[model samples]
Target: MNAGYVRLSRDDDKRNYTSIENQKLIITQFAAENNLIIDRWYEDDGISGYKFDRPGFHQLMADLDKDIDQVLVKDFSRLGRHNARVLLLLDEFQERGKRLIVIDDHYDSMQTEDDTIGIKTWYNEKYVKDTSQKIKRAIGARQKAGTLMIRPPFGYTRSHKDKSEIEIVPEEANYIKTIYSLYLQGSGYRMIAGYLTGNQIPTPSMARHAQDFAKGVISKHKIAIQWSDSMVRDILGNDFYTGTLRLQKRARSTVHGKDKRVPKSKQYVFENHHPAIVDKASFDLVQELKKKRIKSNYRSSHAQPAQPELSSPFGSCLFCKDCGSRLTPIRRPASGRERKYYICTTYNTKGRLHCSKAHLIEEETLMNDLIAYMKLCRNSLCKDITAYNLECTGDEKKTSVRKQTELQSRIDVLKKQMQILFTQKIRDLANAHGCEKVINESYDAMQKEILTQICESEKQLKTLRNSILTDTDKKERSQSALQITDRIIEMKTLDRRDIEILVKKITVDKDGLPEIELRYGLSHLIPCSPSCHLNRQENEIIYQCMNLILQSDRDYTSARYLSRALTDIHYPKSAKGVLPYIGLMLKAGILSQGSSPQKPYIINKNRFEIKKVMDTFIKNCCLV
Candidate 1:
């Protein structure tokens, strides 16, 4: 059996010799001429010649297990551009006692003895490397010049008049705008992709080409590709929709020459080259969301402790109106001991209350007030949203005048260009191509330019339509968000899990009133007063103990042991029995697990104070 191989390095070159039909024709002719029966055909279309990893290449290797007689190619270049790969394949053929032939080169593996051919092969290898480098250089130059280089970005098509200008692709451009608008509205990347698929919009890669082949518009059809989250994310992150081009966001190695994407900081960006679908404000909003997503991803990867679920709807709704600190819930013992309440986070890290006043609020009364306020906010938002939507519809008349002026200007330019091209054709005064040729070129340019203008007008119309929908949608969504917040708040009690969905931050005031801030702008004020407060002298003494804990000769295990002991002092009488068990663990060395825990524990002589300060210095940046 004779097998044939083919490859085209410059991608575009494949259009000539590497076509499926051409490969089949060459393989069949070579097989018949050599009287070699073929068993099967292998093909790898659009595969690079520089890489050995290819679909058809694997099939060919697998076929070697069969009783193959020889391998044939139109030329040696079909095998590979790499010299080492060619040499390895040649040695493999020799070991198998199989012959290789390149009909175009008139070379046969069976002959095997030519010093001149060896030099030619070396030269061919150099040629391949040189050609690859030249192509890379050309692409780099185009990128630096701010031209649309390889692929026209999503929502745009390369301009026929000047390949550098990327004209808006109407259908795709509207979809791109929708993606950005939705993203700013808190819809995520995957949601935007789902929306596109749900709307049955043709993905950018598969859209119909506006080119006309009969009039010699490039005779190529675009292949349809499916919508994916990756595609949506790329569009959302791209600055192209904002009329800016960001270049050189990648680098090729100086040694191995493998290209690696350069970091975002290295990218060269120029703004306002084309019309912007997303303004700077919306783009910045999207960026903030992106940052939040990045932070969330990082947190998830580290597996941070799960947030506690809120027990009452109103429980998590309360915050310190003064310092914005969350009021931590403190439950009393089962023995009917008095309930205690306090805040979460250090109120004063530097032994000063100049920045914040620590406030502690009782939990029971806070929830009732929060629930009442939420009901009020919900009704208010509903009323305001309805009023805003009505006002927005009243402004529709303003756009008609602007649209008429734009359309008139575009029509006038198109008519003038058509007349000039026709006049040039009749004059026959050009030095180079005669009037006919000049006229034909000018006519083609005019048609394409006119088409581009029409596409722009259509895009503007779409924008006008979208703008009408936007104000109403914004009001509706805002009302919906407030309603969701109200629902979260209306719950009499909440657990930590419920709180995570609605509450972002909680703060306690000096008066111990907890003011809850909802995720969607619903605010509620409540009375969350603390049961007790240690005097300034007492807190200072505790601070002194903390300093001692840090200066102690004890290790972490021993110090943490002492810290837990001090924290347990606030426990009620019924839970007091558990303290002995803790003490037993300390004595048995189980608390520190046979290691000293003394480093984190502190004891002070003044005010009979005891406290624990863990050694949590994060790389010399000590944080409380």
Candidate 2:
């Protein structure tokens, strides 16, 4: 029995001589010429010959166990590309007393000792290797030419006319802009994802599938639009929207290994390769905000303790100036009033040895100071916003104005339709109970979608207007921001969300007075009051203890230790007598008690400085 085997590789060759039909014809002609009868034919199409995992090859091997006398092929290349696999198959056929013939190569495996056939097989393998190398070279050339190698990002698609370039999809681009606005406005990743999903916005995969189907790249299939937190995160993280394409991002390490992402340094990027959906400024801002979110991710996992103040309005935005770590909120009610104070995380958790100070600040005092500061700078902040707007105004004012009008018009129309739908639902309220679930879901989705559209249009308008703000426009924006701040300050109950939307961070100074930095306004440094006053003898003794405390180099010295050190330094004062000095200093405000387990008295640096300067002044006066 004789069988014919043929293969056609996608990239290797699809030309006339290498086509499946051509190979079949060549094999038939050779079989007829050689007077060999062919029984069955097997073929693998559009598959690589470098591997024997092809379907046709497997069928041929299954039939090899049969009483097959001969296997006919167009050439040694069609049998399989790998030299070793081809040689092994030839030897196996020889063992089975079956002749494997390559008609085009004029080779026969029956003569296993023939070295010429071996050379022909080697050349056939080289043809495949050469073809593969050429394909890789072609790709490298395209990459060098700044070709768009990836599927277009979420806000874009490949141009209908030019497959190599991306064209912005207006509707989809709006969704992308809304995502940025939502994040910048203080929405979390999961929040953004839920918002998109709730709005019934088509997921990236679903949108891509539809686009591909329309382009005839894919056949008709049910597209399940599912939005996930990961998908939302990817869109937020992608730099492609900034008009850059980074290609060859990931590759498998080896045949059996997992896919490994290539670092940015190793990636080939085409910057400004396409029209940006999100501007570089906005993109950069979002990236920085995302980085802060990542650093504070651990803070979110912390469950609120039993006290109300554990849930501070500052959240992770409160930082200890001394340790550069987040300040931990401690609930310590003084007298009967509930109070919360923020302290250095290092000092609170790892002890004062790790951090010299807690940078403690009363939450109410911090907020009051912040409010006072905002009121002080409100007018200047308004002017600054106006100046920013004016300087950042885009030159394409006419074009942007037209686009804004168009978008606003669409938004108005959608709103009207939604209002009509809502009215209809209200009118049909009696009959709506049975389908309430469906109706509510549809209504909510529609409402969110419309709101998303309005937000997107406004964002685009802002972008177009503020791309390059003029001096006059800056004044207008500053005035607008000032008005918003006025409203925020007037609110009776301010929460973390409210604060997060306006302030970038709250930096606590070493003295526990917070420096509240508005996102776009000036940073306000709250003045700290002196905690204590000292008398003559108290100043002299506390000054000595302060020196000892400074020289100790420990985080802080206990009042008991300071007393013993004072006794040694004062000569006349015994350790027993020094306890009264300690009591006097603690009462007179020279020392501050910490929340340490033993409630040890720590040196009050502010008061110590006050006494140090006085001591110097008195000594200089005496000398004079």
Candidate 3:
């Protein structure tokens, strides 16, 4: 049996002679002239010759060892532009007792010895490489001029007046806005996707198909109304909806004919290139929220909430104090009832040898503890609003006006240098007799250095500007903290948003005690007034002893254990030396004496007076 192969690429489509139909016609005429019958045809349309993974070519190879004894093509280039692969194919045919024929190159394996096949293949590959370079240069030129034509994003359509411009499709734009709104309102990607699909809204591809159908263009493809999380995420991440044109994100690889992603720094961006569907501020905020969600491991971005009411407010904020791993929530059947508990993820996955214990605590217990802590903080803030204001005011530093002016001047100078370099490049290009390449290369290197310096200067300037907060900023922050704490105290139950706004982390110890770290340094505010007359050194010793006892796995710790722990941490206290502090704590009702003398120290942290003394000592030591 004989096999005929034909291929046409986008570059070849411009030439009438290289068209698929024309190539097939040429092969048929040659076969007829030679009295050879062609039994099967393999066609690869609009695929690059540099690629070897064409479906039609794959099918042809599968039959080559079975029914086909000969292969025919219009030319060797039709087989492939990859020189090594084309030459190997020719050799394989010769060794397999099969005949091969090329009509345009006038080559026949059975009748002629063509030693120039390698040279011909090499020339074909070189032609492809040169054509690829020319296309890239043309595209780059257009991109630099901001006139490169690209497909409009999901919420837009090509303008009739200007092919390079895009106009927002109102219906699709509304859907885009809805997606952003839902995401900002604490909806994950999958939830948003389900909502859209449930509402019978068309997907991006389906919308395009409907538009074509309205114009009387018939298609046999089925348009499904299903939306996927990935589709929704893509829409949310696309900056084009913010009136920005971000192009050159992907470039074709010349060797493999595959698209490779270009780095963001290398991609071209033109702001305000079109009307926006979503405002820039909202879009930027969504991006920041997405990043925070990912870093926190809050939930699977693609997962829909199983039960909204059952969702834990501590989502990803809960952790094990010992292992520093997230506490995964689980529902278990206990005493014929369902109980929700959070356990150390490390202990559950890696076993007890890796983590000391499960660090398990009931969800209700965590909620109550967190609320109580917030209330304590609120009370402390209320007791001395002036003191709270003073503490928070020191948190922000006033930027040096002289340094900011220096950064601004440096940035301006660098930008001016870049402009001068660009002008010099243009002047050299226009006046150069034969040194244009050298001139442009030198100018580009200099421009890149200047741009990097400008970027650093601008970042420093932004930091300085942000650090120079006014008195009003401090007052607003203090007020915000008070309001959030008040809400926490009044709410019946906490939700995910509330947790995200108020808490940074909640680390649980082996004894199921939670230590909450409030967001925005709210935890730094002392929760009780320090009326104790202890000196700084004495206060530090007390604080360390209390922390050691509370963090211990055992209920009771002796003075020897506390001394060793403190010494290992550079406190350098002997067992005899720590006994004095322990006695003082016991006298102050912070530590209780154990029943046995072997382990006589007990830290009853649940006692109200103990908590008060500890808080006072913590304030004196500045350990808050």
Clashes within 3 Å, all models in order: 38, 20, 0
**TM-score for predicted model 3 compared with the true structure:** 0.56
Model 1 residue 100 CA deviation in Å: 2.9
Model 2 has an lDDT value of: 0.67
lDDT (tens digit, per residue) of candidate 2 on 407-521: 5686688678779878876766657768877877877766665565565445444544545544654564455555667776797346654666567777776655566666653
Q: How well is each residue in 329-394 modelled by candidate 1, as lDDT tens digits? A: 455564465564555434533322633655655554354434444555555566664554456555
The most accurate candidate by lDDT is 3
Candidate 2 clashes: the total is: 20
Tell me each candidate's TM-score.
0.44, 0.52, 0.56
Error of 2 at 564 (Å): 46
Which stretch of 10 consecutive residues in model 3 shows the poorest summed lDDT? 528-537
* Cα displacement (Å) at residue 422, model 1: 35
All models, RMSD in angstroms: 16.4, 18.2, 12.9
Best by TM-score: 3
**Residue-wise lDDT of candidate 3 within 1-624, one digit each (tens)?**
988999988755355447788888888888899898888899999888988999999998888789998889998889999899998888788888788889889888887667787899999899888878877876775564345476577889887895655789999999998888777656778888888988889998898887778879886667667999899999999998987777788987665557999999999765555677887657876786698779866553344442355555576678899988888888778668787889999899999999989998778657766665666667776755456556655653332566677678878887888888888789889999999889988888677667655764565566556643346434556564467567668984677656765677788887566777776676777544121211333466677777776666776778888889988986766575577778876887667888889868776665455466678877756765
How many clashes in candidate 1? 38
